[model samples]
Target chain A: MLRIENLNVSIDSKEILKNFNLSVDEGEVHVIMGPNGVGKSTLSKVLIGDKNYKVNNGNIYYYDENIKDLTIDERSRKGIFIAYQHPQEIEGVNNIDFLKTALMARLDKPINLYEFAKSIEKLSNDLKLKENMLYRNINAGFSGGEKKKNEILQMRLLKPNLVILDEIDSGLDVDSLKIVCENTLEYLKENPKTSVVIITHYPRILEYIKPDYVHIMKNGKIVETGDYSLSLKIEKEGFENIGTNIIEDNK
Target chain B: MNIINIVNNKISNSKINNKIKLKENKNICIDIIDNTKLYIEIDGINIKSNIDINIDENVNSRIFVFSNSIDSKININVNQNKNSNLILNSFYKNDDVKENTIINLNGYNSNIEYNYSCIGKTNKSLRINHYFSKTNSIVKNRSVSNNDEIEFEIIEYVPKGSIDCNLSQSSKIINLKENKCKIKPILLIDEKEVNASHSSVISPINDSDLLYLMSRGIDEHNSINLLVNGFLVNNLNLNEEEKHILFEKYIFRR
Candidate 1:
């Protein structure tokens, strides 16, 4: 359902991603594994139409339409959602209010309040999130695990066709991470038509949600693409020997 | 639906005889709507404005006034007797407008809270003076101005040995256009025992924050609107209807 080819991105006259290529079909999950500062987050931002990262050369297609010309909201309307690595704290905007606005924007119609509350309660219970969080401001004073659960809750409510989870398991403890992984996989199982791109440096998340494709990103480009076994290899042996020199890998 | 229906003002000095006095257990509320205008001038000589509010008193008043000429000046004195409470809010914004306002208080055991939010985007000048005498009174002032055409000055005075009084002043201005603007907030504290603090920030939005929001589907105008709303939300004590009217009039007027 998603395809990116020959993507070249730069920021502040510094080249980051060079000719990266990847493709994920429907009912498939792709996990991008890479070290820090290796442009994993950059790829996520670029796909969501982040303006800071300039795309020097690339073509991204969702379904059959070119998404490079689309705005972030337009992309979101087309079923693209990005769970930010660092969730922002919006003080006065209630979490339920924000989710409703976003869901309505995506659906082009006002959601039923009763159904919304019911679904949110069910999802929160499954994700182990506090029910009182629905009335509080979005991510305001939320613990790291709480923030990740909030992201997943949004993902569930919006029901986007393509959901990008960026470093969602980093700050979560073992129990919370297990809960998050199980909830995410359950969502995917329910909507088997939906596709996901999980971005993380570790493979522990894979223990819960099995991925179809595993891609290693070093520097700014995708150096290797393999089945789920590739993820295990990267987990066992570090990314130091797989790609070229670190500088050339960065090129 | 309408809180204060009509505003009837008589500018002549004879109207002073019918002036209303607030008792120690009373509360007062005044509202304005539909192109209402009021011009008040205080000569700054022997001012006696006293109102006895009750404990846990609630006073809601909105005073909107602007000067058309350069020589317009108003002196206001409010003295609250001991153990009373008051909340005073003020908003100022005008172009090619000049006005001077002075407030003085003399030794009353009252807890008075004052808030001022000034947005001057045009050619204007304002001089404000505030002096307090009693202890344990708290004053908070927050002002934000856009554009560079307006000149503003604020002066504060805390008398000697006023203990437990706290005052905070915050001013933030953004120079969107190329015009000269100056904001000077002066705090004169003669009492070392008082708690006083002030802060000012004058600059445009950070490039990184701007980029961050823009990347999240918000354009420049919407980003600025969010920031401006955040800046003004704390001082907004409007009811539901008033808040709706304000959003319709000023916020969503585009």
Candidate 2:
């Protein structure tokens, strides 16, 4: 459903992603494991069409359509969603209002307020978010866990076809992580065609949402691709121990 | 809530409500002796007026001043007695408007909270003088200009012997066009045992915030509109009806 061919991305004249390649089929779950500063998050930003990340080479394909020139909003309307590593705290923008606007834009039609409110209430309850949070500004004064849950709520509401979760488990507690993963799993069950790309530093979240493939990213490119066992191997012996032999063997 | 109207230097008091049609070159005086809430509407064109307000001791009052005028100059003076509390919310939209406001805390434990929002060419200055101990003041001003320049100067002064006073001033101006905007927040404290803070920002709508909103599939124009609405309407101490009126008249109309 999503394809990146020889993607070379840079910001401020410094290259971040060089010769990066990845592919995800419909209904596939791909987990990307990488250490800090390995350009994992940069890949996610590039996928979402952040203008700051200049694509110096290659193209991004969404369902075989080249989306390299699409704007951020255009990519979002095309069913591409990225849960940011650090969600922005926008003051004065009410959370419910923002979600309603987004939903309207995504559907390209005005929605029934009653249905929208009901769905928001149910989703807030499922995510263990306080009802008052719906009235507050977007992510303003929200705890780290609440911000992550809010992102998941938007994903469910928007029903994107391709989801890129950048370090979704960074600030979540055990229960919050469980709730978030369960919500995601429920969403996937309802929409079987949805594809997920999980970006993380550890295999903790993988225990909840099992992945079809695990790719280890280093220096802005995927070095090794394996099944779930690769995540466990990397966990047992850190990224430093994953040597050139393993990369060659995997290739 | 009492609604008072002064039209063309004439006063007609009703038990419930009225309107204010300010006349050119006029002086208006208002004295509040009891706890009351007031909604004052000042509507005029090319008028100059001076208003004096006095609040008696131990009284609590809230006033909302909605001014829709053009090419007007207005001066407001307010005095608060002991243990009085006042909340003033003022909104202005005009082609050219100059407003000067001075507030004096004449007694101990008096408090004043002032909120001002404006659009178009405006020059506004406010000074809050703390004359007694334990007085408090909070001043917040937000302005937006599409073409003409807008300037705001807020001064909070605490003289000597006015110990334990708290003063704060926050001012921001959003210049949508190429017009230059200014915000000057000054805090003059002669007392040692007082808390004072001031912050000011004058810029266009934040680009990162706009991008964040747009990433949710909202177009750039709508995203900017939402941001401008939030910047003007949020954090104002207004009731539902007042907020709706402000939104319809000033924010949405733009």
Candidate 3:
């Protein structure tokens, strides 16, 4: 479970989040739909403790703890995960190595490479990822779909309690989107205590993985909160018909 | 296990009778061999020395050298004859080492593949000189260095009128907790009809890479360790299990 109170985030002296507040209970999935420049991606990054977004006035709480003091990696270790819109292309950093290193970080002993390799192969297969890409540099030359699947592969390997997916369905084709959404739903089913927060401009993925709550972000704030029908409304009618102007999209 | 092992050096120029000769087509697995003195090749001999290989016309051979030492220097010269092919693999882990490998593709249509991996505990230097003497000779060199300096040089010459020879050099260096480390890859091509290119990377584990790894619950130091190990040892020609052991005992020190 995660909670935010009166959060105002800014980057380079430009305001991004204006008193944004939201809360998601355990075993729940929440989706945030908005037009361009509505701080949807910024909120996801802030939740994962990305340092680029400076919190001017706010406090993020996870369970009973105020995560304001936690570092980026600290928040990640505390069961907070974020899937970026564009995963970085890292050369010479193998996917298996990255995953195993992250998995080993929680342990005090040396990593069991053989078992780690087996688990990775199994998870990658479950995600329909190429086994060879696991050996290559992390997302170095991967296609957009491959990048999305790789993100899911990390989610499977990491199994964090709270998953934040930012534009995960943006670049995926129909088939890849289905695979990603199906795997995500499967992961949620396995971890009933887990929660998901997806930020997107389209509702196609909501058709695959329905959310219990939908929030429409505008002008650095959530202006409306409703159920899955909110996402459907934004899908049929654009954000303009949702009582928000294009001029107010970015603040 | 590594391909080459370094044992005690036996042949010294201090004595006058240090010249060593060998039979043709002979395969040797020893601690050390000083071909300058201990190896001799004569005509009409079916000789194939695995170490210090020399491929004559229409000959194809492969060699492996696995070396481990505190301080040593080994020089290997490979000469490819007309229409000949040679593949050489070298792996060395040492504290102080100075090694120079000279490869000459002198005959027409000769080809060679050379790969070397080295782990440096202290100050060490490695130099390689590759020569393309005749037409249509292809040469490739790949080297990996960890913890110290390496100067890899390749000189591809398409002797006037020599046509369509290709040369490639790739070198990677991982410098962590290492302040005195550097890599220099020099490619010298002397002909217009030849294709030659070289790339040398000397870098620490980048900050973004560390952040990416740490975002998955890995700490900063462990993230750097993982990145260094991946850069230095991944996708190499040696044994992964054996290399993992080496990392635990020696490289990782845990």
Candidate 4:
């Protein structure tokens, strides 16, 4: 479980996340949908301990332990995973080398290269990725959808307890979206104790992975909370049309 | 040629210029043509041999210089004939040294490949000059410095009529500690159609690289080791034993 209580975050002295709170329990999927520039990506970046974002106040807890001062690697080792919306392109670093290092970092034993290659081959085949991608540099010259699939591949290899996916469905065509969603949902089902926070703009992915709770965020705050129907309403109308509905429901 | 073991050497103040000629294609050791040039020292030897090499037309040769001396001062002069190829590969771990090498490509379409790698905290001054005596000649060099105080001055001179020649230099300096490393590649080309390029980089292991490596559970120290190894040992055509020797000597010893 991960908890964020009244987290006030700012970047470059400009306020971003103000009085924000969210809790992800075991065996649950939470989706946050909002308009652009509403701190959806900021939440994910802060959780991953990106130094560009400064914490003005508040705390974050991972499994009841305060992770406010933990480094990004420490947070990663603690099983808090974030699939970046825009994954980093690191040249001259081989893909298999990176994955093996990550797996080694998470596990106490040395990962067998044969087994690792087999798993990567299976994942590559299932995602329909290029066969040579494993030997290529990380995300170097990959298409946007290919980069997204690479992120999902990392998620599967890392197998963290709590996963935060930021806009995983963006840049994905229809077929790639289905492959990504199915792979993610299958992983989530196999590991029912894992929790996830999916931050996205489109509701297309929600059609596959049902959310236990849907939150509408605007101006650095969640304005509405309901079942997946909130996302459906927002899809039918727009963000502006849901404000009156939130007021009506709250009253 | 077999490279000998290292010995604690002393500096010597003697100079010997030995001339060698190649009419037919052959591989030759440095001491075979110029074995009488000896610098006297107590514990170990200091090599101060000046070599002048002249190659005939269509001759191909390779020269290997493996120095285990702790102090050395060497100078080399080269003249190549038409369609000839010269390969010079030198590996050294010296204490302090001043070395100069000059090549004159006097024949059309001649080629030279000069590879060098050095280890130790020595003060090194190296100057390499390539003079294009004819059209369509080429000279290329690759060198790596292992945290030494080295000032390299490389110059490629092409005359106004020397056309279609190629000159390139690639040098890398891996610094684990703060050190003085300077590289100046001066291309003095009078020809309009000649190809000349130079690239030199002096950087420690990049922080982003370290972070990316450490993100995979390689701690900072081990990450640095991996990156330094990748930078220094990769891209070379060394055998496994040579690579192990290089890893144990230049990269890991520092």
**What's model 3's TM-score?**
0.78
Q: Which whole-number lDDT from 0 to 100 does residue A31 have in model 2? A: 95
lDDT of 2 at B65: 74
The predicted structure with the larger TM-score, 3 or 4, is: 3
In candidate 4, which residue pairs get closer than 3 Å at backbone N, Cα or C atoms, i.e. clash?
none
What digit string (tens of lDDT, one per residue) describes model 4 on residues A177-217?
A: 99999889878987899998999997889999999988888
lDDT per residue, candidate 1, A1-251, as tens digits? 88897889999999898888878788888999988888999999888887778999989999978898787667877888887778877654456656765666677877899998898889989988888898776688999989888888888877888988899888889998998888888889889989989999899899988988888888787777777888889889988876552222211
Off by over 4 Å in 2: A243-251, B5-25, B44-49, B159-161, B176-178, B188-194, B239-245
The whole-model lDDT of each prediction reads 0.61, 0.86, 0.68, 0.69
lDDT of 2 by residue, B113-188 (tens): 9999887899999999999999999888988878888988888889899999999888888888869788888888
lDDT of 1 by residue, B1-254 (tens): 21211112212221111123222222222221122222222222222222221222232223322111222223333444334444544443323234343444333444555554445543222222223444343443333455435555666677675556666666555555545666677777787776777776666645544443433444566555555554543454444454445446444543
TM-score of each: 0.75, 0.91, 0.78, 0.74
DockQ ranking, high to low: 2, 3, 4, 1
Model 3 achieves a DockQ score of: 0.51
RMSD of each: 7.4, 3.2, 7.4, 7.1
Which scores greater on TM-score, model 1 or model 2? 2
Q: Residue B203 lDDT in model 1? A: 64
DockQ of each: 0.21, 0.62, 0.51, 0.23
Better of 1 and 3 by DockQ: 3
Question: Model 2 over residues A58-163: C-alpha lDDT tens digits?
Answer: 9899999999999999999889998887998888777888999999999999999999999999999989899999988899999999999999999999999999
Clashing pairs in 2: B5-B19, B6-B20
- How close to the true structure is residue B13 of candidate 1, measured as C-alpha lDDT? 29
Better of 1 and 4 by lDDT: 4
